[model samples]
Target: MTNRLVKHIQNLLPDFTAGEKDLSPFITTRVVKKDEILLRENEPCDALYFVARGCLYLYYEHHAVKQVIHFALENWWITDYKTFAMKGPAVYSIAAMEDSELIVINRQQYEALLNQYPMVALYFNTIHERAYGAALLKQKTYATTTKEDFYKYFKNTYPDILARIPDPIFASYMQVNLEELVQLKQSGVS
Candidate 1:
């Protein structure tokens, strides 16, 4: 699992090395069962998960209902960033959607690793930039696109997710009504 994690990181930043033995102690591996919550709203998010297998959902509750914000699949990173950065209670909850293998690293250890490995820091910065850009694109999309367009955009952007995730969860993430999603799918729009 550690080798796998190292390989995934190497894919992002070629400077990463598994054989160095320098980063081994900083990471801990865990297997999470489906539906297991890795972090909960209002709780401190002390760690970030690097997914090795399966999927996880990042969600928050609104008016007593859960709203999924994103899904992290293999080779993706998942965490409550607001809480992790601010040292405040988390605004979201993260849970395993399928039995998952993850490399869990505490905030302190992660920071240490970044400082020790400049390439890792650069890689993480790149990821942050991409995530921010995606958020900006989504905002622009919401402002400019119709519901059908939005669905189409989501389908195109996250084609893997469309095939793997259930409709209701996908609808929640897309912020579209289930009926609308059904209509779009049935009409061959998505």
Candidate 2:
């Protein structure tokens, strides 16, 4: 698992120096069962998780309804950035969609790594920027497109998600009801 963690970091940060690789000793792995809640709302998030296998979803409860924010699949990172950075309660909850393996770096360890290896911060910053861009694109797509078009675009953009995610969960993530998602599927949007 340590070797896997090191390899993952090396692949992600191709420019990592020998000293940066030394930080790998601080990363740890966790195996979460299906439906396991990794982070609950109102609880501080201690670590940023990198999904090594399977999937997890990040969501928030709104008027007792769970609204999905995003899904983290293999090689994706999951965390409430605000909560993690500020040491505050999370605004969202994260749960495993299936049995999952994750590599995690807790806040303190991550900070120490950053202090020791400034270049490593660039890797995190780059990924964060990409995530923000994807979120903005999704928001724009949702705002401008009809449900059918959105579904089609989603299918095209995230074929792996279409193949792996359950319909109801995927519908929730798209902010659509199950029936609507079913209708779109049956209508041959994909």
Candidate 3:
């Protein structure tokens, strides 16, 4: 079987390579149903998940409400990095937003791969840098923009993601109300 995760890594850095043979021993591919929790809040989180197909989300419950941190669409990665590094309980829960195929890597495997291949380490460093940049950009965008501007920016920038995610989750991610998102959707604001 073609390993999509391996392919994604190779695409990022064609010079230094990690093939299926190198990663197969350290990874597990799983298919999960929608709403199935991969990592729960306050639970041990040992794996980093890569989305092969379908969608996943990372969120935390606050005052009995779920506040979405981010979504992982196809070719994206999702995990509580704090837990992955510290080997502590997860701060956020990760779950399938759709029936999804995931590539999972435990910490040991993560360490082994990083040690075994310089390219793999570079691959992850690139991923982390991009992730961090995105997080900061999202923060800045949210802080600087008005609600409607934020909504418009999201609609314009991530039409695919906007289309795939459910209303409630999207609202949570946007920190907007569902009715408002509905209105925005119908408002032809884009």
- The Cα local distance difference test for each model comes to 0.85, 0.85, 0.88
Please give, for residues 1-190, the per-residue lDDT of candidate 1 as tens digits: 7777777678788766644377787888899999899999999989989888999999998988779888888888889988998989999999998899998999998988877876887777877888778778888997799888988888898888778888878788878778977998998985
Model 1 residue 96 lDDT? 91
How far is each candidate from the true structure, as Cα RMSD in Å? 1.7, 1.8, 1.2
| TM values, all candidates | 0.91, 0.92, 0.96
* Models ranked on TM-score: 3, 2, 1
Which residue pairs in model 2 clash with each other? none
Ranking by lDDT: 3, 2, 1
What tens digits encode model 2's per-residue C-alpha lDDT throughout 157-181? 8887888888878888888999999
Candidate 2 lDDT at 52 equals 84
lDDT of 3 by residue, 1-190 (tens): 2278878887898875667887788888899999999999999999999999999999999999999988898888889998889999999999899999888889998888777776788888888899999999999999999888888998899898888999999999988889988888888888
> Model 2 segments beyond 4 Å from truth?
19-21
User: Once model 2 is optimally superposed onto the true structure by TM-score, how far is the C-alpha of residue 87 displaced, in angstroms?
Assistant: 1.1
Worst 10 residues of 3 by lDDT: 1-10
TM-score of 2: 0.92
Q: If both were scored by lDDT, which would come out higher, candidate 1 or candidate 3? A: 3
